[model samples]
Target: MPPKGKQATKGQKQIQEENQSTLKFYMYIIFGINAAYLVLQYIFFYDSFTALYIILFLWAVGVNFGSYKFMSSMASKGIDLNMEAGMAEHAKDVILVTCIVQSISLISNYFWLLWLLVPGRAFYLLWVNILAPWIFAEAPEVDEKKQKKMERKMRRH
Candidate 1:
């Protein structure tokens, strides 16, 4: 690493920018492919579940995106949120797998059951995100007397 007084070299900055740009391009491509699959689902099978699948696809993407933003913000604050981030990533994987399985379920039985997990995960993420503020709340400070009284009460118990 460079000394504290020195900024990153121009070459390092350029490399970092190029890497981020490449990563962003790849991410967009993957998302586009998923969207294309949903479009094909609509074209080939125009039914009630078709729209539901589309909505769920968008919802899953939104949840994952929100999780990414949340983790980035937490990291900026010097906090680690690895578990929450992992769940978000796992939820995305589960949804994608469910989509693929549901598509193939047309020929076979039982694959539709996997679709249940998508909404379940969505609800789980919704509940957790809604409660995120309280999850990180700091405890109120107690004056010395109150702290001693609480400690005494704990000992008495």
Candidate 2:
């Protein structure tokens, strides 16, 4: 027979795995939507060849570097590094933020002052480079036991 605590641990592990799978599914869905948007960008803004690639490259670099910094800081703080989650979250944020800033500026429709929009992309890139990793890099870890305990606690409420 398993130890009393061990049984709870096993149960907890199963629940944790289920939760992770569900979360991953959602993350993939979001990623797919973002990817589709990227393709749509090409179709709609066919004239913006250089801008699209530049934006993508900037986003990727921002995410990677941001994640690296986050992981490093976590290590320094004695935190477990969930680099995959960090990267995924950072990628999503960079894309989301970039699109929002770009779209909003465009919708303002001030063609006479088109140059004002040029800095929007640059601003996002700079902001992410400086802040993204620091913002999303070091999240709390969810071990099976902690996850189950949280679930049980949450269900109580």
Candidate 3:
């Protein structure tokens, strides 16, 4: 049931359910692939690159998690850090670093599965760093600088 006056149609409800199901399906697939890869890596390449791969993977996870939390906190405080293409550059740098780790992991075929974490991370950034903040944050306070910019634009038109 919707709120007292808000009407949510059946189609909208269905779509939401479908999107959630799809997300779960994708998560299952990712988990399945990584789980299989881990088993194989343990069996065959246990001595090959396990130490370095684990270290690099842990490092990547730590960096991504830390940055996401920091950015999310800033966003929740209505401190929009997304000026210009700074966030885009940050995302690209993250992917680049992940790719570097992925490349090193490519020495073993089983480890190539870890490459999926790269795009997974990009999606994480889009959701956590970008979307969640804007969707759930307080409206930013417009100072004189922004007011003047808006006024100038209005005058131009």
Cand. 3 Cα-lDDT: 0.56
Q: Model 1: per-residue lDDT, tens digit, 1-157?
A: 6568756444545545544553354356446655665666667656644566666556546654554455344434444322346543453365356546545654443665676776787778777877665788788888999999999999999
Report the Cα RMSD per candidate: 9.3, 18.2, 13.4
RMSD of 3: 13.4
Q: Rate the local accuracy (lDDT) of all candidates.
A: 0.56, 0.51, 0.56
Give the alpha carbon lDDT tens digit for every residue of 1-157 in model 2: 5555533323545545544554455445445544654566568655864664556535544543464455445445543333345444544344445444434433342321443343575578667887787787988788999999999999999
Full candidate order by lDDT, most accurate first: 3, 1, 2
Q: Best candidate per TM-score, number? A: 1
Per-residue lDDT tens digits for candidate 3, residues 33-126, read: 4455456557767787557667755665555455455544444444334434655346435544554544446455465456577678778979
Q: How much is the lDDT of residue 56 in candidate 3?
A: 55
Instruction: Tell me how far the alpha carbon of residue 27 in candidate 2 is from the true structure, in angstroms, after superposition.
Output: 3.4
1 or 2, greater by TM-score: 1
Instruction: Flag regions of model 3 displaced more than 4 Å.
Output: 1-10, 59-157
Model 3, position 149, has a per-residue lDDT of 97
